[model samples]
Target: MKTVLKALVLLVVVVAVLAVLVFTWIGSRGISARDDPSGLETVVARTMRRLAIPRGDRNRQNPVPATEEVLAAGRAHYADHCAACHANDGSGETQIGLGLYPKPPDMRLSATQSLTDGELFYLIENGVRLTGMPGWSTGTPEGEEASWHLVHFIRHLPEITQAELELMQEMNPRPPAEIRQQIEAERFLQGGDPPPSAPHAH
Candidate 1:
């Protein structure tokens, strides 16, 4: 029994030492968002995230019922705010999503869909630290309701239709320049007016 205890203690000490060394080395080198985490790093980060959420929070139920109205509100909110990072179908393939370190997961997949509704709601409200996700909850009833609606929308991700995606694209934000150009083009096509030429660079 003593030998077993000693071996366990030694193993724990060795792991702790190695962890500190690795942390120091990484800090010295400077971590970059542009760099993808290693497989081991990814596993560790995910495990840490899972462990950080309280069991009570994870088990909490979504108070909002799944209804068409609720779902529609969620869809609109996601399209306007989240579509930049998480695509309409939750594929997370957009430029911003791809650029993020530890790039956003494909939410339509089991890894995301399998999470409890409460877990999703808490994440939406609390946001993950050191990641791009921002907590949407503004400490208001409206904000909390929005997050709950989003949880419903996330659950519907697997069943999102192509038509719905097309509709969402219309809601997604466009760059100011793109919006201006599109408006001018539409005017011209309607025989209203041709847009003035852009200023030439020196």
Candidate 2:
């Protein structure tokens, strides 16, 4: 018991020193959204996040059953709220997703897919700190159920259908400029006058 405690304490100290050094290096260089995390950074962050979840929470089973109805609700919810950052297929390919510092993860990959359902649920309910992901839980029963539903949908990301993608594109939020461009394109297709050009900046 004494040796185990000593080893744990030594590990903590070593990790703290390494963390300080890494942060100092980052501070000197300045972090950019375009910069990918170093292998060391990735490993450390992944380890810390896994350790953040309580053992009990990690072991808890998902209450929601996998059903088409549940999956449909999850799909719609993900399209409406998550697609901007995570993308409809969980590929994290959208502009916002790319721009985030750490970038949203590709959920279709084993890195995400391998996580236990409870871990995923915990992450959805209580988001990781220092990342773009925000806790989605509303502390309500419906919110909890929705999160559980999303877990099932995440598992299905690898097999997402083209029809589902098309539906999600319609559901995705559109910037006003993009919407206007679409409107102009539609007008031109209908044989209306070409959209007016913007004045050139001096």
Candidate 3:
């Protein structure tokens, strides 16, 4: 009995000492975890999974096949709301996005472990409760349509080239038909000038 009691006392002392050491280390130095893009991405991605509803068919949906009409609407909405943080090409917000403590997601080329249309809608319209993504929908077509348009734009973003991106931005910046007509005229003129069989620099 005495031996058992001594062993218990020794174990308690060891635990107390270890606890004090941990407390001292934490209180004196503190634990500021990594907050870089990668670190923030990791924490957010994990939290999203824990909180958001899981998609049963994540393997099937690519989230990038969008129609041209939807693409157009999305581009416009993206420019107005999402572009500042997500960037014009989903390349992530260089200036505004960086200001976040858990920085805004790059959503550019980083494959979201697997986010679906519904999950994305929930996050965007309702928000993740605490994450930086804010809900902007007022439950109207103009509002909801604009939000979905941004989603469609994001779905097919990776394949778009830098030049195409510039073109899209240019077209979306102005009233639709006027810019479309001008762009079409330019295309028609360019097509008239047949490509020399070989590449040349101006």
| Candidate No. with top TM-score | 1
Task: Select the stronger candidate by TM-score from 2 and 3.
Answer: 2
Q: Indicate whether candidate 1 or candidate 2 has the larger TM-score.
A: 1
Model 2, span 104-177: residue lDDT tens: 98999999988999999999999989999999989999999999999999999999999999988887888999
The residue pairs found clashing in candidate 3 are: 64-155, 74-149
> lDDT: which candidate is best?
2
Q: How much is the lDDT of residue 58 in candidate 2?
A: 90
What is the TM-score of each predicted model, taking all chains together? 0.78, 0.75, 0.55
Candidate order by TM-score, highest to lowest?
1, 2, 3
Q: Could you tell me the TM-score of candidate 3?
A: 0.55
**What ranges in model 2 sit over 4 Å off?**
1-24, 176-202
Superior candidate under lDDT, 1 versus 2 = 2
Q: In candidate 1, how many Å is residue 61 off?
A: 1.5
Candidate 3: tens digits of C-alpha lDDT, residues 1-202: 9999999999999999999999997687644332454567677776765465555522223244467877877776776677666677776655766765456665755554246666555556665554466778788867666666666677667776777577656543446788767756765576544343434333
Model 1 regions more than 4 Å off: 1-32, 194-202
What would the per-residue lDDT of candidate 1 be over residues 85-159, giving only the tens digit for each residue?
998889988989988888888999988888898789888998888888887889999999999999999999999
Global lDDT of each candidate: 0.88, 0.90, 0.64
Q: lDDT of model 1 at residue 126? A: 88
